[model samples]
Target: MSAAGVDSAPFVRLTAVTKRFGRAPPALDGIEGIVRGGRITGLVGPDGAGKTTLIRLMTGLMLPDEGTVEVLGYDTRRQPAAIQAAVGYMPQRFGLYEDLSVQENLELYADLRGLAKGERDRTFAELLQFTDLARFTTRLAGKLSGGMKQKLGLACALLRKPQLLLLDEPGVGVDPISRRDLWRMVENLTEEGIGVIWSTAYLEEAEACDHVFLLNQGRLLFSGPPREMTARVEDRVFRLSGTDGRRRHRLARLLEREGVVDGVIQGEAIRLVMKPGVTPPLGEDESVASSRTAATPPRFEDAFIDMLGGGPGGRSKLAETQRSFAVGDGKPVIEARGLTKRFGDFTAAADITFDIPRGEIFGLLGPNGAGKSTTFKMLCGLLKPSAGEGRVAGFDLRRDAPEARNRLGYMAQKFSLYGDLSVIQNLNFFAGVYGLSGITKRERIELMKEIFDFRPILDLSAKDLPLGLKQRLALACAVLHEPEVLFLDEPTSGVDPITRREFWTHINGLVEKGVTVLVTTHFMDEAEYCDRISLIYRGRSIALGSPDEMKSRIVREDLPDPTMEDAFIALIGASEAEEAA
Candidate 1:
């Protein structure tokens, strides 16, 4: 059914919906909106901005403390079970049994939905074919990649033929290619008269929605088309290119200026957002005037930042403590030559080769389970490679694992801090692990505390800290020993935009101080921060270049200025097609 053929009716209605949790602020306060069938509605907001709570209310999993929530014309409080049976809710991870095969998972969901015996076979066939998982039937769910898991979760949700589908951040950790594919799958179903409520932390992805509900701090900030959001920052966005090696340092200093509202690294340049009434500060210097500074179209993210009172500006305080490096030594800081990792007869990473010089940020990008992690583990000395060499700080990882490890710091995706310990205790533990002691330990810990602004939360438990602080503590711990190389694996997965900018400011700062960074991230925006990128697939490097060069590889007359995301999708799609050929 096309949008023209489908009826445009409100499937879910919120009238003065107010929900409170404990004694803190209301999770959702006085939100009134209508979700129309036959269209995709986006719920855009930062983490803990009441998106999940609002979706839960519509599912009837929880009722609002005040006001009313009506789904499919049924009152949520009085007819909770009725709403649950008619709607499909796929939370972040979904309830896929990892040990079960893909086929068995589908069958289990069919059973849970209580489909008739005659209908089970038809539904199973449709979903397997629809999600393109027919060939991987016998494969265990745990063995599937991150993108495959999301597709399986969507298939499970659709098993009951739901009238309305509620997806909570389906693209959380999936790569750009996978994210685009999953989005197309969902958009196809909306044509069949199903309503969708997609909540996401990635504001850029939400721009395609038919309608969007912008939520922030338990309030409805905006309820309209995404274009309306972009309109808020019209003519305010600008991009300026600069000489090599000066972009990051300039970004730091420019962020503190009164004329600049928010600025981030854009390849070899900075994307600057000027404060209203302030001109682009190109400077009066002849060199600065000669450089190009052009106004670009405003995006959903720019509008979002403007709505939330602008982005994180200026240089990071954390960058001020470290001395800038001269990079006199021309040797690469981190090296992986023909690295291969095998478990039994299965190879995880095969013949991977890359190198990162001092003060460079090298990124390894790949689909989930696509050898990126395997290569990282080998380079970081967590796993011994079956062949080839992994070197850091001029030491062979296999022969001198301890020595190589000592010169590097790692921050895992989950932060990996001790939940039971307080902020100060975690800092102390990390300091000791890196061989700091006596006055050295105290001084480093004190520096971390002062730079990270942890004084208020020193006595607080690690688990209780917010997402931004958790990231800060993790980064602080990683750099406590001042390692020459840093390993950041998905450092800002589900964090909001402001926190991400702040984190990158510090990272760019560290890179200037001669810290070689080997990072892996699913966020393409973050990938732009890398000085160079190696995109791997099926245990092999498929594309390697600077961000601009990568994007230019797929450019044609029809598509002149392709984005990094367009480049990623095109490259992966071309590779897959080639493999099939």
Candidate 2:
């Protein structure tokens, strides 16, 4: 009754759980944890870290190979049906009838739960108001945006008002605004004394949870409050500023130094996570000497990475001679002149114009349903624009589409790798498609394997690899031929911070070698890495400038130190108001 003899009783508890599949390591290696009512419990880990396996066990979808899982004071193995009835579960891929309307889906779920007419009506109205889907009740669930569908799934889960709720990776593939709204609703539910178990790949979400259980490689590394975990690295973090060279140069220097655990560009400074009790090193380089290093507070991410034993060599340790860009009188590598795309009665992109200089990192950012993707597709020659012209690498996109594609590398938002093929097989196939033959192809494949440190997983199938490794494989294939320009659409979406930093480090290395990059992302912090960014909303480029420039434009006196995210929200709000008028 009391979590298999624990002193303090928990609403749900796992005692010495262990699960394994095939010849691989155990999915849950003797894990012990608890979930209490009236608080949000966060299960934070990278993809394939047993977060989903544990969630399934807790919800009675799977039984533990060893030990016991108790929920609501009942053993899950003995009484799975009782657990299912008392618990509301929303998996990563929620099941909602795509052809049915929003109201119809809610009605179906309510009837399945055997809710009375009065109860169903009251619950339906409440869900509609809370999820902000009241206006779209008649709309088909399939037609809803990704965020709306997630909300609809959540509403369906809450229809019965179960005592315990389980949400598995709800923020995956959703935009920032939708993530914020979903968290707000979860918090409100916790206030009503309903227990919640939330699993996520995003570490930042852990700060909002009352308790956190960190899993990695099927082991429970830490389990406690967020502050307690973050405090493990207190006074070890440092901020270095006033560097003289480019961001990559500074980052490279920091990574090269000893005692520097992790370093990343943070606005006008570089935040370094150092080893315990290690002092900042004094460098002979002028850029390093001029920098002012001071101790700073540690973030949750800092401790998490430190606990996991440092990142993949902060900024790519294996250095090579980088290709340089000639900045003389030459046309920009990418250009869009009055580009417009229309779908029947709807305009996806309208008169969008922008230019990306050679070797520059250009960012296209906006909320879901915005025109960023449309604009990107047109520039990549995937779609023929309804009006105007575009060019890439001095080749006209429309007439010279073949030549333009040869000079470019593109990674789509979706997982584009061959699933059935092994890592090396995918690499070979992509290399051949890019026209690499004989020694050149073999040499390039070897180089990519070294660059991404993908040698160990070469024999593994692409579908079985972890999400981070899959991303690396995709990027490696995209740039195998060393194209002049690279296009990334939501490249870092739904990835952990450490993996993102590693991916950006590779991108920075390419940028240093004169590779022009155009990227689209939802993470506001990533915008700081770009030379300039264009924010698209309602099929128009409303703002285009550096991250600092965009932040400076926010003149609201009530707000203090407005971040890039705040500026983006303000700009989009203004654009929406104008359209309504």
Candidate 3:
């Protein structure tokens, strides 16, 4: 039934909806569907798929050029103001006043939403309690952690008790624990009979929806239960284990098989997908298997990749042109000996220690306020440790910072580069900074354009490009000098599945060519690629092991076949419980 009434109609309806921005391709084109009410409906697609545009049109913030958007039986074109009042919108970048206190921001939004004063007090009390932010009401919004800020944004959007809630990519950059909390809060809203529309890049999140709308290039690809989508890949998935300690090399070779649809490193095994009606090429010589494997149930992610015609398959071009080097000459590439950082009376990172050798990928997993970033900066010479050692390539980060930094390439989480410059201009500028000159500079720029395939839009402003394209440009700039080590901070935080797989293919290739990497990410599936992981909490390393080993630690009689994410949440919970005791 519709959220607007007791009648049996969908929550929102679209009839040949179309939207265009300037002379570029249509943001949304002739889309039609019905989102069910009284539960969560997921909206998912790749970057530039018009997910944001569709959400805006439904909120009455923008009017469509053709067809109609009907929310709660009221036509958007005729009753936009009424539609706006009934809908609660939490956009990609929710407008929050960082300078104000938490309570002040809530008050401001309540006033803007026209809530009655008598009704405001009770609602404020309930919301603050529900979000667990009552104790922090007097704190400045800027001082809150990333998770807290997300909670505050949700509270502000819910001030007027909207009939329909619209959330646009709400989980970007949020760690798994915080993400779980956010999910729980949204699930509670659905139980109250409130219709929710959630747009996200995380396919794991989409898997939990009661109904899903899958879109591509502004057109509907599928609109139904997520189970139906997942069922398309039945009898197609398998996990190959017991390899010869060359997971990366073997996974790359498996991608070239004609019967294989998609393949990635899952812990010690390579999860393989065979095309429909094809027999498994099981042999004693195959690296993907030690023995014949049974078919595993497919996930929403597998189906999503199948619909996109498999990932960017084949070997990485960037890896083939590069020469291999050996850095196994008696020195570790990165070292953190009891690393610790403090801010005033509080500690950010404490007693963190790890050693990374050449040609290995190490992952850091932690909560938002946890000291992963602090430890990373100390190793890069961006910050000094309070009472510990940080070294890179045998050079002390504090004393020989320039020398250490010169040997590494860093790509920050927020796309830290010149946004106003053209794509080619940014490439040229970064190349010069890395000491490339004359023919070397010209040759490298052309090579980058060819490798990343950004030549078609080379003259476009960097800010105007889509998120995936901007990510490519950032990565190209970081590797212009071909440093021996790569430091990636949340490298694929908000990208789609296809782009993520492509990025990892390059990373694995670089590792094979003797480039060590230290990376951080929120996606658990991606974390399986790490040789070892350090799970931090409250400024300390609470757990350290390979992903498979970590999963084994959490297994019990009541539960079996636990995934990497299950281990992550369970270990954090155990640590929290122990600390409290």
Candidate 4:
């Protein structure tokens, strides 16, 4: 059911809603939207696109400063309790007890919903089967992977079998397989007349929704089916390809030319988008000119990029830094030999081994709690390896731990920025900790502000900034001392596609200048940027190869045009099959 014929009433409706905090500009201004029953409405936008604010208004957590907000035919301000009782909300950072077992958590939520014993038992069994968590019912919530935790949170939210469900970035930081499982669950709910309003920074997720409300800078840009939006750039997208090892340089050149709306290296080719009423540039590089390219249908992200303005004007350029640590001539900059980590009798990472050469982007791909973090911590010298050893920039991880740490930079999964401090203060403090002072520190701070476009939010507390701005702040602090190696743990997990592309642009520039990057990401599309990847499953590196190599190795006759996500799922599925056998 769409907004067209919904019994003269929407499940929830917002009319010219406006909200503000303090003296700052309105967080949401004059927004109009509706959520219909038995449909998935995606609140899609970038970091500070007012998605969360809209959700709060719908749930009656906050009253709009202007206009009216109603849910289930009741005014949010007067009937907040009634609305709250009927809607199920799962926040970005869900409230789940770390120490509580999955079964216990379910019981707690069931009790909160005041369910009888019979109802509780029925609900628990249904949820367990739906979420595929029956085998792990006794496992603590904290011990589950990021995806499992999300499923558990969803199960708890469904204890009351709400009429409407609201999920805020539930797929953030979750692996592809887990994301698929969660979506399937949501799809099942919609069939039961459970309206779902999910907010996401991911464009792909927004594409799957029945309707999309594109919000940006507190304003609604468009509201309709995703195809209606993507249709704007239908025949404008093209794929250009050439000889191997030259795609990046060709992509950089294409982006520099005028009329080129957006260009990215997709697999072995460059996906190009042209501005409206504009043709592909003539007399360009041979790789672009002589290539036999054809127009393809635009993806949701392609239209999103065009809608935001057809150019890469807001991206940051690579910063100038001293290259004192020379790349080991033909030798690996990072080496892991039989690395292992164990907690009690359970091994988090067992006998994992990989060698990363200088200037290469090495990705550690896996589901959450699959030992990617454990192996990362050991490699970075934060946790001692239970067995074997590794080397970082020529420093032995187990021997010269301090030296190893100093030679590299580490960005945690959740940014480690000082939330209480202003952006400038955080940069200054990180610089000081890195031993820079006086003129050197000032210059470094200024450079970071310029590169990351942080001047606008300089005085804002780190916690108050949007997700993209916070990402920039965290990256600036990480590279302050210009370490030879950088470790990014799920850096672009929750960010929008444009922000992620911009982040990788800077990273690519750095790699060209001899910086080695070790990254862990849930976005399979990002695997294309890495020179090589290791797919980890159950504390083991099951597959190690380049993106193309791995995808090609998956001998699945069923899947044509196999992608990184397909390859990853295939490998994990195979591993599970072998273990069962």
Candidate 5:
């Protein structure tokens, strides 16, 4: 099934496909595309951009309102059963029975795919090794970490070795190492001539594919090689970093306002895109005459930002009313001493200690089962620590659980906002529960609407909003009463770059007003926003510091330049090695 052997046939093809969801708009508007044999094609776009709709059309989960879709030369509408039999489809929220063990999940998928018992056993062994799940076969799928769940989901998908693989944001919430492993598996499949159409919001991951289709607001913006698409914006990006935030912010504004820059905020630096002939602004004491021209090629992320009409500049506004809380002699908002949680003989959270300062953004980072959620639960007073002491917002976590819970806003990893309720109704319900009433409740609701741009969807049901908007509404509900501290577990998990940026805007505004934030995220880029971070591995804080401090500590002197990903890999790898020893 090599590309050379199947050069005569396209693995999957779509012709003038259009799908409409009621009268809102066509989710897949005239999406005419083709996937060739032995190639990895990326469907890249922001959330609600029709990537998922296109995938569904090809997978026969939904038929298009117009046109046709074909898989392996079979019409999808007429031959959905044949297409399903020949394709491996993994949706965004994969269906995995929580109660089933890893092995059982794979076995069930194998049986469902109609694999022979012997073939199933053989494939199961290979898949276990490939996904690195052999060690955890007895562990329940629900007990697995976020990365592990994704790996298991893929394992189930690959059980039958279908001719075409359709993955929808397969690496949405996975760690960097897991993502790398998943990509390697995908490359191997494509090498074996199994065509892949991967829909993802992660632009960097999309760069690995052989071809890319850029979708925007249900329209195909560009289709072809990633290199060609990036070439369109080459020599336009300038990397700017400095110690001063005020100066950097000022320069960013100037560049943005001049209409000559395509800027993206990256940690402490600003990646600015300048016009072909424009000169960079010079400081009074610093000379611009000796400034060298930036020759670096545009990254997929840079190109994406340019395509989004550059960054949000002065036009963005911050909330006016201010609420302040003192750290009380700079004491940590949350403090844990020798905290422990165990389920029978299994240790969910080992003896751990940490201090989170008031008005500071603290990041809780770890692999899926690395004790992040357990610790978060303890802090929020949902689960009592098996041993030791903890406090949140000046209330002892164990002794004053109710008091701590009331003072802190908790947004779970799987945020379950009332879908049937209208946006305003959801807000109102949360507001009432938080003790905000009369004009106070009304004022706060209005503030949230303005801050999150929820006015347009006030009367719309929460379930009707897109993923990004849902995340926004969830966040709005969480902050309705303006809790003293916020506990956000993977708040931006699965959100696209644009939505992620917007979410951070609201977060940064809160930080500016001295609202303490304790968040857990799998996305490394978000770790940059935290004032301090603790890298938890196997229920312990193996690394802790500001992003720069952590980077400096872990990066090797031999390496020319190391990124956050490199630092993370080094730290986590070292931790695992020590545990083995």
Candidate 6:
């Protein structure tokens, strides 16, 4: 039956759909919704909120245990092929061939969609320009940076110009600038009357959608325009700033304990949502300000946090113990002297020299394809340097890579955990492989379960776990043996803001325990958490120092007090302009 008696039928419909594995509750429990045409509808929720499952169901990837799904008036179960041919679905990890060039990938997809040779050429050309990959048509997809890879994925999905597009977290791991570009593409699609159902955990991105579906544990909490949902909770928010930075976390904890604030940490400040009829203590004498005084209405993020029953900021207590090292003293954990890595005529990393102090939290900050990953791979012994020398924990990077590998734990940018294995099974496998045995391994496994609060999902398959839990489990496995130094490449990419905070807490804890950290991240705010950072551009280290020092050095005389983001833009802009000249 058509929904709400609208003359134009809904584009997509799900009625009482349920998907279950084993005896556990359904991954998607009796879900129902209607996606209208020519609008951008966001699916907003935390990990395991059934966003992916719904998308898969709609795209005919899996059969629902019960209920029915309809797309464009075609029943999904009976007419999946027809639905698949009419819709564009881009999964979280797109299926792009590394060996294929940009234009080749698009042409392949166009061919798969059964376009004729002439039509394929015309569509591919248009998509190349639309995705901004025209200049790099010959470049291998694997060689493209994270942001570029995402654009290519979108382009592949758009080859057919289907009436509907399903994007599953398409902006994950992309920088702010690249994200804006990607969104502009989506906006253009909607302008052309192509309906979209985009599932994402990033609330800021969700706010931009025409309508939003708030899901929790396989249940729909609300579905409507973002403004309507936000308006309901607008009066409850409060902006807070404190003189004691250290006390910010403590204060958030206290407010949470008092049951007054549903808050999140936004940089140095906390944005809180006050409970109904519960007044927050602003100051002893001054009048308590209304939510309006907080500057703007509460955002979708604010509403989502309130729905979760509010708590202390996403801070984890499972960090390693604290032990401070002198700022510039002691043997460097990693020392690179004129290190270089090249591929034919291209230099991936060029003449890089730096020393990362032991027990320090060091960061590599740069845009995608700035040689950060190349430098990281070289340091971790995954890739050999073409020239110069480097040491990891006093072991030569080139000559003693095996020895260096043993002393370091490295987490790649992608999800590396085995999906088919149970959480505990994965933990046990890594522990045993790392050489922990018998009672010791058992004890450590139990400790990990407790540390990550994995008891709830310990028996659940890792592949079936949500993104946030999977990330936590991955971190647990990486640190199981407690290596002396760790390398994290975009560890928090794609995680929600709360989970990102929790991940950092764990990282900070590792540093406190004298485990030197070398991490690469796209979130500029994360750079603030590092003791010192190295900014790379075009295969070279362009800037290196403490966050304050880098900021002071890069900002123009006229623009004084430039933020880290501003500093990064200015530094990269100046260097790129110089290189072009």
Deviation from truth (RMSD, Å), model 3: 1.7
lDDT-based ranking = 3, 1, 2, 4, 5, 6
TM-score of each: 0.96, 0.93, 0.97, 0.94, 0.91, 0.81
Candidates, ranked, TM-score: 3, 1, 4, 2, 5, 6
In candidate 4, what are the lDDT values of residues 294-364, reduced to their tens digit?
78778888898899886463233653354544555888999999999989999999999999998889999
Q: Candidate 1, 472: how far from true, in Å?
A: 2.0
Writing each residue's lDDT as its tens digit, candidate 2 over 105-201 gives: 9999998887889887788999999999999999999978778999999999988888889999888777677888999999888777788899998
Higher-scoring candidate on lDDT, 2 or 3: 3
What is candidate 6's TM-score against the reference? 0.81
| Winner by lDDT between candidate 5 and candidate 4 | 4
CA lDDT of each candidate?
Answer: 0.87, 0.86, 0.88, 0.85, 0.79, 0.78
Candidate 1 segments exceeding 4 Å error: 1-7, 242-245, 285-287
Q: In terms of TM-score, which candidate is strongest?
A: 3
> How big is the positional error of residue 530 in model 5, measured in Å on the Cα after superposition?
1.6
Model 1 score (lDDT) = 0.87
Q: Encode model 6's per-residue lDDT on 177-197: one tens digit a residue.
A: 677788889888877778888
The stretch of ten residues in a row with the least summed lDDT in candidate 6 is: 284-293
Total backbone collisions for each predicted model: 1, 0, 0, 0, 0, 2
Candidate 2 Cα errors over 4 Å, as ranges: 1-9, 116-118, 315-330, 555-559, 577-581
Off by over 4 Å in 3: 1-7, 284-286, 289-292
Model 1: lDDT of residue 425: 97
Alpha-carbon lDDT of model 5: 0.79
